[model samples]
Each structure stands twice: as structure tokens, then as C-alpha cells.
Target: MRRTRRDPIVTTVLTLLVGALLAGGWWALRSDPAAPAPAPAQAPPAAQREVTAQHSRQADRPVPRTFDRSAHSTTDPSSTWVIVNKSHPITPSQFRPELSIVRGYQVADPAAGPLTRLLDASDRQGLGFKIASAFRSYGYQDSVHKQLVAAQGEAAADRISARPGHSEHQTGLAVDIVTPADGRCDFEPCFAGTPGGRWLAGNAWRFGFVIRYTPENEERTGYSAEPWHLRYVGPALARELRETGAGSLEEYFGVPGGDYPPVP
Candidate 1:
């Protein structure tokens, strides 16, 4: 052993290697078990979380097989129009009071003029028919909503009154007629019960009007039976609707025609 001399370079390298190993061992031994773990990945911000939740809720909702154009029909070409209440109130202004003139009447669309004449003529025939209501503006609808909420509570009023921007009155194509007081008209037996209401239901189509709602089609209209409501679809379509006995414009057109989708 005394006879061998190690190279300085080799001696230095060996010393460095031993020192590194010792240091690493010491470091491992001294490591603390109590060190905190890294924080979990942060969740999305609150706004983003809310948006995600909204999307999830929408996805869970059922899709309508058909389109209900009642609200949009007057404006959307693809939609077919229908009537609302026929006899409960007359004049379009009653349904849309905000647009009423000083005389308390609302203007009718030019297209509705002919239909109105026809309705008037039908009334003279002892049909007990009258224009119950017509074009409604957004403001009138809001007022109606308030009145209905006050009178019937929110839930019940929701069934009868169209929500603002979701009313047929906006379209200028809808009209309600009077049900007869007696049985002398062409109206059905049901119409005699509400004589003016009945007369219009039986004969509205001849004048290019169709009962937009009916008892058989409650599922589509989102309202109870409304025999007096009529919608002017022009003579051609009116005839078709009448022949088909389709209770709702939704059913007649094979689409949904209101705020909600047809019941599943």
C-alpha cells in the first residue's frame, strides 16, 4: 500500500463522489414528513361555474318535436297564426291597452281588415259573434300580466294571460269572438252554452278564421279550452284547419305554437 501513489485527478474524483453520496443520504434523512402537499387544482371561477350549471340544466330539458309559432307567427313567416279569446273582450285595444288611441281602440293590421269584415258579417247572421280582442302591444301585455297576477295569483293568471312578448296580440292576426246567449245560431251545442263563443267556433273558418285553441288540444296551447279565440290564416289555410278538426294551430300545423313545448 505504501508503494502505490494515486493520481491527483483520480483522488479528487473519488473524494467528490463520496461527498455527494453522503450529502444526499443526509438530506434524505433530514427531510420532513410534515411538509404540506400542493393545493389541489383550483376550480373554475364562480361565473364560469354558473354558466356551466345553466348549460347543464338546458341540456336536461326536453326538446319539442314540433314548433309553436303562436307568439312568433305574426312576425315569423315560417309560423302559422291563430286566435286567442274571442268574446271575453272586444277590440284589439282591450288586449293591448297601451297602443290604444284616445277613443280606446287599437289599429288593426291591413290584412286583418278583411277578416274583421267577415267576422262582422258572420255576427249579423245571428252567429252571436263579435270581435273580442285583437292586436296587443308589449306594454299592454305587461299591464295585463300585473292585473292577472293580482286577481288570480301568479300561477292561475299565467295560464290565461300571455306573457309579454309571448302574446298572439302582437301578431295582429288573432281575434276572440262572443259566445251566443241562446241557441239560434250556426254555432255548436257547446257554443250555445257560451252562445257567442259557440257561434264563432262552428263558423269562424268560413270567414278565414280558425279557433286557435280548443278543449281537445289543451296540451299544445298551454291554456284551457278557449272556444272564442280565432286566428286569421287567410281563407285557404282556414279552410284546411277547419276540415282537419285540428284543435290547435300547433296540431293543425304539426308544430308547437306557444311558450312551452308540447307535453311529452
Candidate 2:
């Protein structure tokens, strides 16, 4: 409808009133920050709804994948994941795994690659890790234990040495690492604080090895902390242990690991 004789003053007043209303609405919106805008009458598309649901499900944060504990044998002596401790012994006491030499140290072939990578990584980081001990035959271990016992007595020997059948070295999955730069700390607890030791403690999980015995876990491991002692359980279990914060294989696996059985 055209108003040919419209009043200019009245039109200006109406324009001002409309402008005032808009300004008031803008201020209201600005001032009420907590108030959400009105929702659309129509629902969002399925894909959009799904996206919103997914985002909202941070309450639905994707569940972390569960690790299969039985992916490898913990009881079989040859199994890469075998748990060897004072409470658990190699069944035959002379069990030997397929061997490979890494830097002149014999280790289970399954461990060779990861151990190699670990060593190489250490070298790259200037850690200069050396293998002080590796696979030991039952007889050798028995002799070693006897020597320690003779030197330091049974109680002291047991703290630092493993009985023949109960030794992880016999499993071919354990390696004693030392740093030539810090040779004085070889097989000593102070090694854990060394540059290489700190690096290995924090990074070895990436290569499937773990600082097997620790002071915090000594009661569970049945030995004093030997940061030099590394047991290969493969990268999978290593990552799981690192993630779950399990300090000892015995604690994680719930296997008995304290003190040797009383002699019959």
C-alpha cells in the first residue's frame, strides 16, 4: 500500500522507534552471554547429528584397546613373555631358547631384533650401552650363584644372584646392560640415575625391554633393584606395562615371585 501523503515527521519517528528496538535487542543479546540462542525448529541432518553425538561422547571418549595378556605364554620357558623369578623356575632348569648374538652377547633370537634396536637407539643417543651379562646355562648360573654365595654368603648372594633354574638369564630373554662411561656403577643401583640409565628407564619400553627389578618392586620381584637387568617381553607388553604403570612382571601377571622355595 502506497501512502502518497505520508507525514515525514511520523515516518522519522517510526524509523527511530524501529532502530531503538533493534539496538535494545542487540544489547540484550550482548549482555546475556549465558543464554543460548533458540534452536532451529527442524532437527539437524543424520550425519550432523552423528558428528554431534561423537563429539559429545568425549564422555564417549574412545575406549583404549585392551591388551591380550595371553598373547604369549608366561609359563613356557621358551615363550618370549615367560615370567621367571624365584617363585617361578624354568621347568627343565636347562631350557635354552634359540640364540642370536647382539654385540657378542647371546640372547633369544626373538629378542635379537628389539635388543639390537635398543642398543642402536642408545648409541644414537650417546648412551653407549654394553651387555655385561646375557644367556647363562644352568650349570654356569649354578656356578655363578655358588661363587657369589661363597664370596658374600647365601643371604647376600641370593639378593644379587639368581639360583640356577630360577634365573631369567637362562630364559635367554634377560640382558644385563652397562655403560662404559659409567663403568664404576656397573651392576650398582646408582646406575639407575646415570644418563644411560635414565634414558633406558624412560625409553626402553619403545624397544620391548623393561628395567625388570626395581626397588619399589623388590618385594614383588624377590630381589633388590637391578636397573641393569632388562627382560624382553616384546613391544606390546612393554607398552602395556608403561601405560598401566605396572612396575614388575610378577605384580602385573599376579605370579608368585618372592623368595625361593624351601629346600626339601
lDDT of 1: 0.56
- Error (Å) of candidate 2 at residue 117 is 0.7
RMSD, candidate 2, Å:
17.2
Mark the 10 consecutive residues where model 2 has the least summed lDDT: 46-55
- What is candidate 1's lDDT per residue for 1-264, written digit by digit as tens? 377889999999999999999999777667956655557698775435444544654576565222222323433421334333221122343343223221133434433555657656765776655454676676878899999999999778877777665666665666655444543432232553564565666766776677666667666666666666666665545655565556665565565444443337
| Each model's lDDT | 0.56, 0.85
The most accurate candidate by lDDT is 2
